[model samples]
Target: MKGIAFDALVDLFPGLGGWHYVPVPTEVRDAIGGHTTRGLIPVRAAIGTTAWDTSLQPMGDGSHFIALKAAVRRAEGITVGDRVTVTVSRR
Candidate 1:
């Protein structure tokens, strides 16, 4: 399998109780084509060296992204707009 990694900024979703995320790039989406189920895609996501099992969720604009919970951010020492190298693989 091909390695998937890319830089993205941490984004915030207002009015959703402080939900934060990192938008998955198109390349990642294309690499895992048609793997979504009910708007969520299961994957093993990693930030730097911390790996976790998470789901990529769809946004209203026909795009998909991954949620970066506070724990992950804190563990990775990253904040919004901070470029992060995210890697994902099929779960």
Candidate 2:
């Protein structure tokens, strides 16, 4: 499938011990064939000029989120509550 791009707000999940993430929009999740039971989907993602390989974590709410590693966030100068443009594609 082709790459998907969108803007989303960075958020911290308390349950995940304050880990930051970008919620993958429902439409994008569907486009990527993501489901709650699908386990992690390997992907290549980019934010600003920082690019990395990570997996999209399926959430219990039938959604998925991309965990933002601290290094990636620091490289992009991003923080929780910031709006970031994300580009993702299955690897």
Candidate 3:
């Protein structure tokens, strides 16, 4: 599958036990497929040279986000609040 690439700001989800993520743009979500009523959508994602197979989680507000694992962030030298370019494709 072709990957959709976009720039996003890494952010921390407040009051959710410190979940870090990058919000998937609506266009990118639409490109991969539309919003899910429930459950996560499997995906392959890359940030620079770091890549991982994860899932796109619905935010329950008609949007989606990809959780940024601590190891991935460490490998990419990124932290919350950093802007990043992410490439994602359906798995």
Residue by residue across 7-64, what tens digits does model 2's lDDT show? 9999998875788999988787667666445588888899978889998888777778
Question: How many clashes show up per model?
Answer: 0, 0, 0
**Residue-wise C-alpha lDDT for candidate 3, range 1-91, written one tens digit per residue:** 2599999999998895788999998888778875564578899999999999999888888789999999899999998889999999988
Candidate 1 C-alpha lDDT tens digits along 1-91? 2358888888888885777898887668778763443478788888977888898888867678899977888898988778888988877
Cα error, candidate 2, residue 80 (Å): 0.8
Model 3 bad stretches (over 4 Å): 35-37
Once fitted onto the true fold, the runs of candidate 1 whose alpha carbons sit more than 4 angstroms away are 35-38
RMSD in Å for all candidates: 2.4, 2.4, 1.9
Checking candidate 1 for backbone clashes, the offending pairs are none
Taken over the whole model, the C-alpha lDDT of each candidate is: 0.80, 0.86, 0.89
Estimate TM-scores for all models: 0.86, 0.87, 0.89
Error of 1 at 81 (Å): 1.4
Candidate number with greatest TM-score: 3
